[model samples]
Target: MPEGWDGTTRDPDEVLYEISMKEDQMLYEEFVQRLEFNKKKVAGEVKCHKYSRRRPDDGWNYMVEKLGAQAKHGVGGGWKFISLPDGSSRPLNDMEKMR
Candidate 1:
């Protein structure tokens, strides 16, 4: 029997199993931290597009439909539909992709 074990019969395999489980938990936690770090780094590198409505009556449904149309046509990169001061819509230049 080891220092913590009782003087009675004790299974060595059970002790080893507990130690392995603890190690596995530690490894999983480290992996999650790394994954979160990587996710934040990638998000910072990526650019998100902004959408603005032409009129006050044009609501969330209209914006969603336009976005769905763009996605259906396989438009990639961060291209945004911006409403100009004169009530005109245009795709904004994606600075990240341009560079």
Candidate 2:
């Protein structure tokens, strides 16, 4: 048997205390983080930022290097998304360069 591995030999109350303490610590940390973020927001330090979600395989370099996408290429390139001039984006297949 492993060291101190006696079956049912440990103190049950102590185990319960340890588990509760760990959970409480986790909840307290999360609350503190939220409180800090709120404080920053109220101080006008938290600014809204546009964020885009992309898959691990979705990126400019990945498109260029892995998928053989031509840089500065027209539509129909292998990139997953096409960035618009208005700070928005769409799937590359949805756009076509006009003649």
Candidate 3:
């Protein structure tokens, strides 16, 4: 990271401020969608499973986030399933994969 790396100012503090603002903006947008996605999950229309073929365990993330797969994204949470590289199959809470 560089001082004023945001490419607008020379003040280092300003750079941090700019970053915070940008993150806040994105967070607001995501928060709105969280409500929307949660509704679908509650409606029994989605399931929480790992969706990323590259990163199965998905780390610590909000449930109403890009979900285990396409239509299932942003609506599944709390479920413990890892997306497998096979593209169609997955193992449920396979802790070994977390490695």
> Highest lDDT: which candidate?
2
Task: Give lDDT tens digits, candidate 1, residues 1-99.
Answer: 578866786599999999999999999999987787678753564344556446555433211114444364325523346555556665645752243
Which stretches of candidate 1 lie above 4 Å from their native place? 1-6, 41-99
TM-score of each: 0.35, 0.39, 0.31
Candidate 2: where are CA atoms >4 Å away?
4-8, 41-44, 49-99
Question: What overall lDDT, based on C-alpha atoms, would model 2 receive against the true structure?
Answer: 0.61
RMSD of each: 12.7, 12.9, 21.9
Q: Which residue pairs does candidate 3 place in steric collision?
A: 51-68, 67-73, 67-74
Best by TM-score: 2
For candidate 3, lDDT tens digit of each residue in 48-72?
Answer: 6656445445343221223344445
Q: What does candidate 2's lDDT look like per residue over 30-88, in tens digits?
A: 99888988888445577766576654444342222114545444444544555655456
- Count of steric clashes across candidates, in order: 0, 0, 3
Error of 2 at 23 (Å): 0.6
Q: For candidate 1, which ten residues in a row score worst on lDDT?
A: 59-68
Q: List the residue pairs that clash in candidate 2.
A: none
lDDT of 1 at 79: 39
